[model samples]
Target: EVAPQCRTASAAGFFAVAMYYQGADHASFRPLCPAIVEPQHYVREEPLFSSMAAGERRAVRRRRLGWFAHQVHQNSRTLIGGWVTGLFGAIATVPMVARILAPRLTSQIRESMGSLVRPPATELHLERLGNNPGSDPESMGYSLDEMSQIVVRILQDIGMVKDFPPTIVFFGHGSGSLNNPHESAYNCGACSGGRGGPNARAFAMMANDPRVRRRVSQLGIELPDEVRFVGAYHNTCNDDVDYYDLDLLPRSHRELFRGIESDIIETRARNAHERSRRFESAPLGLTPQEALEHVEERAEDLSQARPEYNHATNTLVTVGRRDWSRGLFMDRRAFVTEYDPAVDDKDGHILTRILQAAIPVCGGISLEYYFSTVDVEGYGCGSKLPHNVASMVGVMTGAASDLRPGLSQQMVEIHEPMRILFVIETTAEMLSRIIVENEGIRRMVEGNWVQLAIIDPSNSAIQRYVDGHFEPHLVSDMQLPTVQSSMRWYRGQRDHLGFATIQEPESDQPMNSSESNASAAGALA
Candidate 1:
C-alpha cells in the first residue's frame, strides 16, 4: 500500500525512505530520498563534509566523529565498568584485611608517624583602624560604629544607598548536591569554599536594626521605616531558596513578603527552565515546573553524573548598571555586578573597590573553566564518576590516586574555553589609572589573561583597551532578533542561544504554558 501511494504521489518534492531490512522495495526507493534541502525547508545550512587537508586539491574529506562524540560512545562504558569493579573489590578485601591486622596495624601506624607535629590553628583578628585600644585579643570584636561603617560600605559597593525597596532581599548563593565529591567547588568562592548564607544573614540583621539605621543615616545614607531587609540563601544547583528571620518580620509586612516570595518562586522556575537546556538528560519539551522538579531530583539522585554544570560557559563579566545590559539575553554566561557610575566620585574610588572583588573572583572562575576545558584530564579532575573523596579535603581519581584539583569533566563538559572579557561602563582614563594603581589588575590585563573593554557612561560608546591605549570598538549595523519573552526564544532548543531583545508583555499578568507556546510559535512564523 505504501509503495502504491509513493508511486501515485504528485507533490513537487515528495520522497520516500526505507526503514525495514526485510522489504526489498523499500530499499530500492532509497535512491529518491533527499540528502540535502534548501535553507527555506531546513533549519540550518552547512556542508556535510570538509577537506581533511588544507591547500590540497585532491584531499579526501570523509566525515568523522568529534573527540567529545567518540568519548561519549567509548569512554563512558569503560569508566563505569572500572568504577563498579573497584567498588566491589574494595568492599570484599578491605573489611577482611582490616579485621586480620586491626590491633597490630594501629600500633605500627602510630609509631611510624610519631614525629609529626600539628601546626597551631590561626585565629582571625578584626582590628578597628585609628584606634590603639588593643594589644588584648579579647577586644577584637567589631564596635557599633564599625558595624555601621560596614553596612555603609556594602550599600556603597552595590550602589544601592538611596531608593530602598519596601522588601529587600540579599541572596547569598551556593550549591547542593548529593554523592558529589567536589561539591565545595560549586559554592561561593568569595566565602573561602563555604556557603555565603551566614554573611548575608548577618548583613541583613545589622541593616534592619534601628540603631544601625540611625548610625547609617548620620554617616550619609538613610533607611525608611517601611523598608524591610530579608536575607536568603539560594541553592544554585536546585533553584531552592531559604529565607532567614521570617518571624522577625512585622505582621503588616507579611502580605508584601508573600508577594516577594511568589515572584522568587516564578523566577526560580524560569531559571531552572533555562538551565535545563544545557543538561542533555533533560527533555527539551519540559515545562518550567517540570524542569524545576527535574533539577530538584538531580540534586538528590545518587546515580546522576552531571548534577549541575557549575560556572561552565562563563565568558563575560559586566561591572556597571543593570540597565546597560538589561533585556539583553546573555544566556546565563555573564556575571553581572550592578554599579552606578553616577554614585562614584571623580577618582572612581567606588568603581575601584567593586573591581577589586569582581576581577579576582570572576576572573579566577573563568580561568579555571578555561584551563579545565582545554585539558580535561590534565588540568581538570577527570570524570566525576570515578572520583573519591580523600582526607575529607580533596578528591582522588580512585582509591589510591593523587589528589585531583580544578574542575571535573562533568562540570566543564559544555564549557567553551576562552579568556573572560571584562566590560566596564566607565571612562578610559579612570580605568587606566586603576590598572596602574592596582598590581593584580595590571598583571591580569597586561598579561593578556583576561580581555578588557570600557563603555562610555554618557553615550554607551565602547573602547577596547590594547597596549596601554583605548581604541574605539566598531559596531556592526546588524540588529538583534526581537522576541516576546525569553521563554519564547529559548524553548525547545538545547544549544547555545544568541543575544536577543526581549520585548515582554506590558501587562503585569503572567502567561500560561499554552499561551507562551502560541506566542512563541507566532514569533517563529
Candidate 2:
C-alpha cells in the first residue's frame, strides 16, 4: 500500500520489475489458485529514508528550500508581483502611505529622541483609573460580592488567610521555543491555550481594588491593608519572570518587592540548570547565567531538537495546599494547584471548582503528550522537521499530505506516558459528588482519563479513586537521592531521577514542606 499502484498493464516512461521466490509461481496460466500464505524469505534492501527526525530534516530542508526560493529564484511570479506592487505604490501612494504610518512613525521618532535621558517609570495610577461601567454585568461594573468570593476562595485554597504574605506573586506560565508546532500546548492550561500572564494581571488588578477589598471585609476574609497582589509571568522555556504593574505597588512596599528579584534570579538559574541537564549539547558544571544563556540560545537555534521539553514527565497534580509539596523538587513536572477543603463550605464547593478546572486542562495536556509519545505516526505528527506550516492552520508533511495532528516527535520523546495523578485536598465523598455532577469531569474519572486522589483535609492520607470507588494510595516510603536544592540534584545527571524533598540551606530555616505547612496552618487557625 505504501507503493504506487500499476495500471493498464503497460507503460512508456515507466518500467515494472517483479521479484519473487522460486517456489511461488503456479503450474498453468489458465488455471486459478489461491494466493500463497507466506514468503520463503530472501533478500531485503535498506530503505532510502534514514528516520532522521525534527531538527535534522528541518536543517537540510530549510537550506534546500532557501536555495530554491532565493538563489535559484524559482518563484518568479511572487518576486515580480512584489516589484510591481512597490513600483505602483511609489508612483501613486506617497501621501497615503505616509498618512497611514504617521502616528506610529511620530511615536517611534519621539521615543528615539527621548532615549538619551532615562525615562521615569510608567506610573500605574490605579486610584485614578476609573472602572468601565459597561464592561461587567454588575451595577458598579465591579462586584465586590463576587470579587470577595473569588479572592477569599483563592486565598483559603493556598492556606494563607490570616497571615498574608507581604507580596504574593501569581506566576502564570507559558513557554517559548523556535520552529515548534505545539508551542501553545506548553502555555497556561487554564487560559484556553493562550498566555496566562494577562489572566494573572487581571486577577492582581481585581485583588488590589479598594472597592473589592471593602466587600471582602464584609465577607469576613480580612486581607491586611498592607498586603499586595503582584502578577507575574513565568517563562517555562528559560524560567525568566516578568513582573507586571510593579509601579502600582505602594512606595513603602517597594524595597520589599525589589528584594524578590534575587529570589526570581535564583529560581530562573536553578530551573535553567535543571532543564539544561536534559539537553545533550549543554556542558556540565555550568553556572546559572551560563545555563540560562545556553537554554535561551537553544530555543533560538534552528537545528536544536528539543527546545525545553513541554510538560515532560508531568505525573503529579497536587491540588492541596502548596505546603504539602512546597520544597519538593518535582523536576518541573507537577502542577501544584492550591486548594483548602477546611475553609470552603462543606458541600465541596471550592474543591469542585478546583478539580473541575484542573482535571480537564491538565488531563488533556497529559493524555495528548502520552498518546503522541506512545504512537508518533498514528497519534501525532511524526517530526516537526518535514512539517510545513500549512495556511497557518495546521502542519503538513509535504505540500499535498493530510494535515498532521497532535504533538510532534520532539516534544514527547522524554514524556512518561501515564494518567495524571490528581491529588485533591477534600473528602472522597465530596470528590465523588463533584465527579457525578459534571458529566465531562465524570468521563475523565470513570473513563480512566485522569486518576483522582482525595487527600484528607486534616492529614496526609491520600485516597486513590478508581472504578467509581476510593482506595488508599499505597505510598512507598522509598529511599531516593537527597539534594539541598533542585539545581544541586540535577546538576550533572542526564537521566530521570527519583522523587526528592528540598533540603533547607540554613539550619534555622523552616523545613521546606512541613515547616511552611505548620506555620500557614497556625496562622490561618
Candidate 3:
C-alpha cells in the first residue's frame, strides 16, 4: 500500500504539472490522454442568446444562435492554446522544481545523494615546511617539539595515555653504500651535540618537537639511549660498510639493529651454498624426511621457547621448505602437527571460531590469497618470507580485538608472533614438472588433510592448486615477473610482500553427504 503522505505529494505534483501545461505555448502542448468532451461544451451561452419580440423573436433567435456558434468557435481556440502552453510549461519545469524541493521532501534520500557524490577518504596529512621531498631528514617538517605534541594528541585519542606514557622507538632506513656521498657519516651528527655528530642532535630535535615529545609522553613510550637505522649497500663487497654504519644508532636501538642483522645474515648464508648441497651439508637439513622433521622439531622448540606468556600474547610461525619436492612423500599433517602443536590448542580453536563468524560477514570462503617466491640463488632475501611474516603479525595484531573481547583487551600486551618463511624460485617448465614429478606434495594440500593455506604469488601453478580443490590464491603484485623486476631494481632495499593466514574450517558440522555424493557422481559419471 502507498503511504498517505506519498499519495498526497504525488497528487500535488500531478496538479502542478496540469497547471504548468495549461500556461505553456499552444504548439508545444498536446493532450497526453484523450479529451472526454468537445470544445463546444466549454463556451459561454448567455449573452449571445438574449435578443427577442414575438414573430421577430424567432428571427432574433436565429441570429442569436449563429452568434453563439461563432463565440463557441473563438473560445475553443483559446482553450486549446491554454492547454498546449500548460503542457510545455509542465514538461520544462518539473525536473528543476523537484531538485529545488528535494531536500524538504526526503531527508534520507538527500543524505544518500550526498554520500554518493563524496570523494574517497584522504591519507594522513604531514605538516612540514618547504617543498623538498629529499630534504635533510632532520631539518625537514615541523620542529621536534611540534611532532611530540602531535604524538600526544594521537595517544590521547587512542586512550593509550591519560598522562600515562610508553617507551618510544625510532627505526630508520637509508641508502648507505660506498657509492653514496654520506656513506662515512652514517649517524646524524647534527642532531647530536659535538660529543657525537648529528646523531644526538637529531634525537634532541625529535624530542624537542612539541608534537613528537607530547605524543611520546602521552603514550608513555620512552626512547632508548640508542637509535637503530638500517643502511642498504649496493653489493656484497660493501657489506662491511653496512655493518659498521648500523652501530651508529643509539644503544636503545640495539634490539632493532639485531633483527635486521639477523635477516641479512640468514639471507647471505642461504645464498652462499648450493640449494641441494646446503640442506645436505648443514646439520639443519640432512635428508628430505629429516628436513620435514626439522621443521616440526623447530616449531616445537620455538613454541617452548616462547610459551603462552600471558592472556595477551599471540604467536604465528610459518615454516616452508626450499625443496618442497624433497618432502613430497612426507606426511604434511604429521609434520605440521608435530611442528606446530599450539595450533591444535586454544589459539587454533579460537581462529576457527572467528573464521566461522566472519563467513557471514564476508559472504563465502572462496577469497583470494597471495604468496611470494624468491630466487634463493640471489644474494638478497626474497620477498615471500618477509611479506608473509609481516602480514601474519599484522593480522594477529590488527584484528585481535575484532576476534574476541578478551583478545581485544590484551591487544597491546600480547607479543607479536615470531614468523619463519621460506622461498624458492625456478623456471615455469621446471615448476610444471615438479608438480607432476612430486605428486605427493600436491596431494598433501589438495587432499584437505593439512590445515595450511598456500598462496602462489607467482600465479604459475596457483590455478592448478585451485583446480585440485586446494584454496590457492594469486596475489597479483607478487607475480614472478613483477618480483624479479623489483629485485633487480631494489635488491638490497627492504620491501613488504603480501600474505594470508591459514584458517581452519569454521564449524564442526561435517560436509553434507548429499553434496559429497553429487560431487563424486559427477566426477565418475
Candidate 4:
C-alpha cells in the first residue's frame, strides 16, 4: 500500500522510468508504471522519508544547498561589480564637476563674505609738526617734509604740475599719550584733546589763512569745498577708544584713513602695554571702577592744562583717551600747496626734501596722500608715497581722460602723420572685421597704412610666403603704418624695413605677376 501510494504521488509519477531494449531483429520498450493506493489513505498517512536510503537523502540536500550557494555567489558578484563601477565613475567625474562648480562656489562665497574681510592696512604716516616737545620729526620715526617734497617732485615729473602747482591733500596720524593708568601710553600727539581741540589748531590756522590760500592758488592747485583732517588717537587703557573725528575727512578717504588709524592705535597700545610695569600693590583701597575714574580725571586735567595751538576752521581733531603719556601732538596736514621746482631745495625742509628725492627722472609728477601711522613702521625710510600715490594719481588722471576724450585725440594729432600699421592676423576675426565693420576699418585704414597679412599657418597664402625663403614681417598689428600686400609689392621689397619714409603710390607702375608671386611667397615665408 505504501509503495502504491508513493508511486501515485506526482513526484513518483514524474520520476517513473521508460525502458528501451535492443535486439537483433527489432526491439521496443514501454513506460513502466508503479502500483497505486487509495487517495484517502495516502492523504491520511504521513510519509516516512527516513525510510529512504541515506545516500539519496544526502544527494537531494546537497543539490538544494549547491543551488542556494550559487545564487548567493552570483548576487554578491553583481553587487560588488556595480559598486566598483559606480565608484570609479564618480572618481573620474570629480575633476570635471569641481571645475564647473568651483568658480561659482568661490564667487558666491566671496559675495557673501566680502563685507567681513578687511582691506589691507596702509603704510603711510603723517609727519608731526609744531610746539609739542616730543613732536620731533625724527621721533615719530618718519619724516613728513621729505615725503611731501617727494610727492611734489612726482607731480612735476608727471607733467601734472608743469609750471603751476597742484592742489595737494595731506593726511596725518596723531602722536600722544593716553590718560588712564590702566590704559596704555601712546605717541598720539594730535589726539590729546577732544574733537576740534588744540592739536588741530595749527592746521585750522593754515586752512583759514588768506596768505596760504593765495600762495596755493598761485601754484595752480584748487582746494575742494570739503576739507579733510584725519587724526589717530591712542588708547589710554586697552586700545579701545572711540575715534572722535573720523567724520572730519571726506567720505572718499574714510575707508583707507580709518584702517590706518585703527592699526596705529592698536599697535601703539599693544607696544605700550608690553613695556609697562605691572602693578604690585594689593587692591586694599579703591575699587577698579573708582581707580579707573580717578586716573581718567587726572588725565583730563592734564590735557586741559596743556597749551593749545590755533588751527584752521576746516581742521578737526581726533583725541586719544586722557591717559596717554606721550602727551598731545599734531599730525601733518593735507593741503594743496605749490613749491617752485627750480628754487625748492629738496633737502632743506621736510616737504622739499621728499620732493627732490621723489621726482621721477622723466620730470613729471602726481601724488595721492595716504596718511596713517602704519606707514610709519613699514616705510620708516621714505618709500611710502610712491606706491599708493601712483595708484591714486592713475585713478584721478583716468577720470580726467573720461572727462575729455579730446585730450587723447589732440595728443594723437600732435604725434600725427603717425604711421600706424594695422596688421590683421588674417584670422576669421580679422576677416569678419574686414567684412562686417569694413567702414570702420576703412576710416582707420585711410588715416594709416593698413597692412593685411595672412596669419593662419594653414592658409595657402601663408604657405606660399613661407616657401619663398622670405621672413614674414613681425610688425605689431595695431602699430602705425598699416602695410598691406599691395604696399609691399609697391615697395618692391619683400620685407618692410623699420620706420622708413612713406612713399607715394606710383601711377605709371603696375605690379607684374612675378612680383606679386614674389611678394606672396615672401609673406608666406
Q: Which stretches in model 1 have alpha-carbon errors above 4 Å?
A: 1-141, 509-525
Off by over 4 Å in 2: 1-146, 476-481, 507-525
lDDT (Cα atoms) of all candidates against the true structure: 0.65, 0.60, 0.26, 0.26
Q: lDDT: which candidate is best?
A: 1
Clashes of 1: 0
Q: What's the alpha carbon RMSD for model 1?
A: 24.0
List, residue by residue over 1-525, the lDDT tens digit for candidate 2.
Answer: 000110001000000000111110111111000011121111111112332243344445545655765742444357776676566656555543443345334334544764432222222111212343221112112334555665665665554567565666665566776546767766655544545554445457768888888887787878778878876777777576888778688997776565455556765776687788887778887887788877766655445567788677788787776556656777767776666556788787767765655677678878988899899988988988887878878888977789888888888888889988887778878888888898878888888988877778767787888677998887787576667677667667888777787674653433333223221110000
lDDT of 4 by residue, 58-169 (tens): 4455566668868755654686866766666667565444433453343345446643322212121123343231323333211333333323332332223332211122
Q: Please give the TM-score that candidate 3 achieves against the real structure.
A: 0.19
- In model 2, the Cα lDDT at residue 5 comes to 12
What local lDDT score does residue 385 receive in model 2, on the 0 to 100 scale? 83
| Higher-scoring candidate on TM-score, 2 or 4 | 2
RMSD of 3: 35.8
Kindly give the number of clashing pairs for every candidate.
0, 1, 61, 78
